[model samples]
Target: MIKENPLVVSVGECGLDYNRNFSTKKQQRYAFREQVKLACELQMPLFLHEREAHKDLLEILDDVTAENLTLPPIVVHCFTGTEEEALTYISRGYFIGFTGTICKRDRGAHLRDLLPKIPLERIMIETDAPFMNFKKGRKSSEPIDVVDVARKIGQVLAIPFEEVAGTTFKTTSSFFRLD
Candidate 1:
């Protein structure tokens, strides 16, 4: 569908997720590599997902990018990895997307610790809507909750919310080639 349609903005929310065993590791790797191939073929940005499979995911991406310099941009969506892991991806020149999980008091500590190390230009914030209910009282999250994501990032990075908003907007826009 993406290959046939010009309206398809990016190539995926495709990658490996071992946390829930939704699919076997082999199946995930095959699917992920195939999608990366499609993204490379189409020259569209990638919207990626990764859980406990960073090492394998990185290896696959490395292999894909090794033979092709024209591959589209890649964003590791809803990243919740450690500082070292995040730094590894950053060093490889990929963007990292954050979600409302960073707003949660209990779960966000590690993310907060690592946020400062990520360059503002590479940060992309998301809602992970209908899933991440970051607020204590809210039943579900919506797209508007991206503001809260930025707010939490601002708080952690000790920067103004507006600056976070502006930088993330530019980062996402540029990554997606929205301009």
Candidate 2:
């Protein structure tokens, strides 16, 4: 198991994906629960993948907290959920990872609006390579595209580009610490 591997830094690619439903809801729920427990038990961070399942996701996390389990630091990767959902996750002390979705003026408008609601400290930026095409309709996003994400964030929040880049870099580094 990855938990036994010293090189493992976080438990992930885990969470509910209702949009595709590639995995049955039962299977996803069970796996998500187990992974959350494993991460909590191991004191490791979580890199989650969620799409159109915010309600269920929050319920599950709340259940774990009800059980007195201390959740590890969690970053909802490529977060493009609703403003309410984003606020809910923020309230739970979970971090939000922004992808190129915010670059889409129309589609990303809500996220831009919610950005002001989220504390900068709880923010992280990602390229979501081979997944997000945030680079002006390129084949797919690459690590270099992270600059675009940072730039959009700076533009929306009215913060300087350098500060956005430096803060997110620091936040990500601290969240996924080894040991």
Please write out the lDDT profile of model 2 over residues 30-148, one tens digit for every residue: 99999898888888998998999998888888898789999999999899888888988898888999998898878889889989999988999987897878666577878888898
lDDT of each: 0.88, 0.88
If scored against the real structure, what TM-score would every candidate get?
0.93, 0.93
Clashing pairs in 1: none
Off by over 4 Å in 2: 1-6
Runs in model 1 lying further than 4 Å from the true structure: 1-6, 67-69
RMSD of each: 1.6, 1.7
Q: Please report the candidate that would top TM-score against the real structure.
A: 1
Which 10 residues in a row give candidate 1 its minimum summed lDDT?
1-10
lDDT of 1 by residue, 83-131 (tens): 8999998998899999999988879889988888889889999988988
